[model samples]
Target: MNHLKIRSQFKYVQHKIEAIDKESFRYNYNVIEGDALMNTLEKISYETKFVAGSDGGSICKSSSKYHAIGDIEIKEEDIKVGKEKALGLFKAVEGYLLANPDAYN
Candidate 1:
């Protein structure tokens, strides 16, 4: 199944969005497309232009839409805690890699 990419960039974006008023949140997403099942990733050799189109942008949001994305719906406390866990994990992993450069191989 397709899962949202876990990256520090996404974490930063989440933190920034959280720091702002949550009530103001409307459009939220980074996924252009994803498969709901396994082995469904768009083939590496294929291109979206062949089927999708020139516009890589998402659909325009309606002002009436008030629903939030699933990832964003996590409890505020959990979001904060999750980021803290992520920060610690990142530091630990990177620190290990830096101390063992050959481990990258």
Candidate 2:
């Protein structure tokens, strides 16, 4: 497994890569020190698999699970915001890959 740390003005995030291969990747992240800590967001786990598409491209299948601290329930709106941010990140990566065809090959 690989570990990464990201620091921003408002948050300190940690990422752990649990598994990776040609077809699948899995990881977990947590905001160790941030505004989210005050809100009880503990961690998030994600898994993504790539499969061959009918059109000779690769299709991505992904899932995310969120964890909350103790008995505090995560709000629906917060979950939606998280999902939207994840989608935006994915789209940005896709755009970069499309622009740089040889990247990560």
Candidate 3:
């Protein structure tokens, strides 16, 4: 994606992820608060396609990045959840980041 598009999508996902982090904080899930989670959320949001193609394949342009992330994979199932799906994907990425800190380091 272009810089503008990436920035816009980052903001969009960041807003949604902040809501999730707020709830996690309220519940004392302090582990959910960090830049790693935010980065993952931004990457997924910028890279994901909310819909699939007619052939049942991803329309997302960052297919290579998606493969690289591995555990943070966004499939058609997540897309089908509509608006709430971003949360699910964010949580998955958070978990992966938490478990694989060296991946980012």
How many clashes (backbone N, Cα, C below 3 Å) per candidate?
0, 0, 0
User: Which residue pairs clash within candidate 2?
Assistant: none
2 or 3, which is superior by lDDT?
A: 2
Q: What is the per-residue lDDT of model 2 for residues 26-53, given as tens digits with 9 covering 90 to 100?
A: 3333434456445686767777777779
Q: What is the C-alpha RMSD of each candidate to the true structure, in Å?
A: 17.3, 5.4, 17.0
Better of 1 and 2 by TM-score: 2
Please list the C-alpha lDDT of all candidates, in the order they appear: 0.35, 0.66, 0.37
- By descending lDDT, how would the candidates be arranged? 2, 3, 1
Rate residue 53 of model 2 by lDDT.
92
- What lDDT is obtained when candidate 3 is compared to the true structure? 0.37
lDDT of 3 at 36: 34
Q: Which residue pairs clash within candidate 1?
A: none
Q: Output candidate 3 Cα RMSD.
A: 17.0
lDDT of 1 at 84: 68
